[model samples]
Target: MNKTPLNHWHREHGAKMIDFGGWEMPVSYEGILAEHHGVRQACGLFDICHMGEIEIKGAGAWEMIQSLTSNDVRRLADGQAQYSLLMNSDGYAIDDILVYRRSADHVLLCVNAANTEKDLAHLLAHARPDAQIIDLSADTALLALQGPASVDVLRRLGVELNSVPRFHTLDIAVAGVPVLFSRTGYTGEAGCELFFPAAHAVKVWELLLAAGADAHCRPIGLAARDTLRLEMGYVLYGHELSESITPLEAGLEWVIRWDAGDFLGKSHLQAQKQAGLGRQVVGLKLLEKGIPREGMNVVAADQPVGRVLSGTLSPMLQQGIATALIDRAVLSGASEFFVDIRGKMKKAQIIKPPFIQRG
Candidate 1:
């Protein structure tokens, strides 16, 4: 199995490791519940070096990126980033990625670990002959510090917390190592994602721990990360998003740029927009006691309407919550629904996310 640069550190810290996608990652450190509360109340540290990073350079870089991604690339000025999607001809998502515009001639694409190679190949296939593309996954290491007190923790580490706006990036040195610091995160918090040399992984990790001592920050794992994102209604790649699902069907039409000129799936997306969406992703809250899981049936009026894509017992809300892709007609017409848990049907209510607002 694949392992990140901080794998040994995770094991040393007594983390329960699990195989996520193909990488051996920590599922929990102290405990999932404890880690979840830590991030919500104080702050938490995460090793996210398993994600993939790709670089595009040269005069054609801007044009090449514009033609490949769903979001308006022209709107991204220097030192800014945008959450976008890489799409296929059928309008299905190849992968959801974050595009960082370092400059007109230099850009970076951060993609999911599972789809790294696939996304890279797709980009290379459509890139112009003059565009220079390079994969920097092996050389880059990323770390995330998140939660309500995240800014205070970073300020203790000598970072100018107020200057870097959300979705913006800066190049600076932390602990004497060059770092690419981006004010972005998955956990819906005021935090920063730091990218630095792979060789400096342990040093940076140790420094962050020492710096955040007074802030009461703890090391978090994948288990809590999953729950945190679910509470925020953020989409996960394999669950809320997939190769067979289009952005409109996933309720991500906001990211689709209709007036950005020609793109990979513009024609198909335009057609769908004109015809209207047949299905949609919706949030579900269980009215009765029961935990909702993936592949569970969603029923309306004693008949199947859709299947749960991602669900969990929200640690913050203390209730069962879920996201499902159901038929648009059924979802709009029905006021209430049910989730089939084992042989029992649990009552539920359709609601818009997010289940828990960030504190």
Candidate 2:
């Protein structure tokens, strides 16, 4: 398994290590519950260095990247980022990704760890013959500080919080280390992702932890990361999306831009939008006593209606919430359904997603 430069520090800090994709990463530090709440109320630090960062440069870079994804790349300005999806030729999603427009000639794509290599090969195959693509994952380190207090913490570090607009980035020196700071995060909170050289990552992590605010900053890991995203009703790559699933079915139509023009998946997506959808992804709130797990059958009136793509006993909502795909016909009747949890069917209710929206 690949280990990040801060592997030793994670061990020293009592992080529960786990194998994620090909990288060994922390599952939690002070524990999942503690860290989850920390990120919600105060702040928590996360090591996201294992995620892939590939740079596409050269005069034809934008032309090359535009062919592979579902969204329009031409709209992105310098230092601006947009969420997009990698698609199969059939128009199904390979993964949802974030693309950073560094300049007219350079774009950076951040992909999920598991899909990094596949994403590289996929993009390289169609890249302009002369355009340059570089994988800087091995040499880079990424950390995220998230919570309501994030902006305040960054202000203490001498950054004007209001200046870094959402989806914008600043290549600035922080704590004596040159780092690329992006105003982005998976958590539905105010946050920023700091990308810096691998060697100095440990010091950066230490600085955040040492800077005390309301309820001191601490290490958060994969466990809380999963819960956090789920609460926001955000789609996970493998769970809520795959090459078999289109972004339209994943409730991600916001990311698609029709006016961007002449991109892959545009034709099929346009048809889907016009003709209406057969299935829609919706949220389920478990009213029954059982916890909903992934792939569990969702039954409506004792008959299998759909499948649960992602589910959890939400810490914030204090209820089991899940994202599921179901026939559009059942949506109105979805007020009550059964989740086949561990062989027994338990009651559930359909509701708007984001079981935990920002207050």
Of the candidates shown, which would achieve the greatest TM-score relative to the real structure?
1
Report RMSD for candidate 2: 1.6
Q: Which residue pairs in candidate 1 collide?
A: none
Tens-place lDDT per residue, model 2, 1-359, is 99988899999988889999989999998878888888999888899999989999999898877877778888788988989987766767777899999898888988898998998888877777768999988888999888878777788788866688888999889788998889999889888999898989889888877763554788899999999999999899988778766788888888777776666667888888899888878889998666788899999877888899998888887889899988888877656688998888888988888888784
Native-referenced Cα lDDT, model 1: 0.90
Q: Model 2 residue 62 lDDT?
A: 88
Model 1 TM: 0.98
Estimated TM-score for each candidate:
0.98, 0.95
Model 2: weakest 10-residue lDDT segment is 208-217
Residue-by-residue lDDT tens digits, candidate 1, 100-211: 9999899999999899999999988987877899999989999999987888888876777668888999988988999999999988877889989999998998888888
Point out the worst 10-residue segment of candidate 1 by lDDT.
154-163
Q: After superposition, how far is residue 51 of candidate 1 from its true place, in Å?
A: 0.3
Off by over 4 Å in 2: 213-215, 333-335
- Pairs in steric clash, model 2: none
